[model samples]
Target: TAHRWIGRAYFFAGVFPAGIAVLGVAPLSSTGFVSQVGNTMLAVLWLATSIAGYRMARQRRFVEHRRWMIRSFALTTSIVLNRAWLILFVILLLPHVDTTYGGDQDAMIRAAAGASAWMSWVVNLLVAEWWLERGDARRRTHRTGQAADRRDAA
Candidate 1:
């Protein structure tokens, strides 16, 4: 379908470049292990999920393809989620924990930043897995009920 191809094009063109910029270039401009590692982790995740989705599509597993696509979308959104978390941490949570790390602002910020970076995609992927599994379970249940209904009718 056009929709699927569009998604593929976007991933290949838009997302890949942005991901490269973030993972490859941002670290060079910034000073810290967290950004470099975090960006790399996210880029790796994106690449893995994209490949999984494409493989599913190629194998004619439409349902699995949809599931993988959902997972890929979730991972993509994680970048925005990470920024949102950082903003929330800066506004509401960071002040309280500011004194924990010997009141060193930079240390506390780095810790929070690292935590948020990991949490963002990790949580998104977990939620995506749950959603996919839940839908599959429902389909199974529905199919089972239909079979029982047919047997009773016969």
Candidate 2:
């Protein structure tokens, strides 16, 4: 299927290059040292989640694979969230720029970008995990209910 093929291509193209870029380019980033570290951590988690998903699929652990893949997808989409967070942080920090950052716009932005970068991926991954857990709980509850019904009928 085209969707699967596209996903495979993304895994190769998007995931690998992102990991490589963070390792090779993050150190050279002007966003400050802490942001660089955060970027590196995000990259590492992205690659790790992707690899874990692929391995789980190969090992026939479909549920684990699904969870990992969802996590990977959430991380991948964090770029979009990062942009949104950047905007939100910037707007919220505007009034504080003069007071909190000593009138340094660059410093304020650096703070905003750093916070957004970390929050984007971390929050996304957390939400994904929470959603997946809720789904699993719901399925377990439904299964238990069905089992009870069958026993009652017998």
Runs of candidate 2 with Cα error greater than 4 angstroms are: 1-4
- Predictions: Cα RMSD each: 2.4, 1.6
Best of the candidates, lDDT: 2
For candidate 2, write residues 1-154 as lDDT tens digits: 7956876777788897887787788677798876788788888999999989878877879889889999999999998999999999999999998799999999998999898888999999999999999999999999999999999999
Q: Write the per-residue lDDT of candidate 1 for residues 1-154, one digit (tens) a residue.
A: 8988897796788667776676676466343577558767888778777778878988989888888789888888998899887777666646666467676777667766776777788899999999989998999999999999999999
**How far does residue 146 in candidate 1 sit from its true spot (Å)?**
1.2
Candidate 2, pairs of clashing residues: none
Model 1 spans with C-alpha error above 4 angstroms = 25-35, 91-93, 96-98
Instruction: Give me the displacement of residue 18 in model 2, in angstroms.
Output: 2.0
Candidate 1 RMSD to the real structure: 2.4
Candidate 1's TM-score reads 0.83
Q: lDDT (CA) for every model shown?
A: 0.78, 0.88
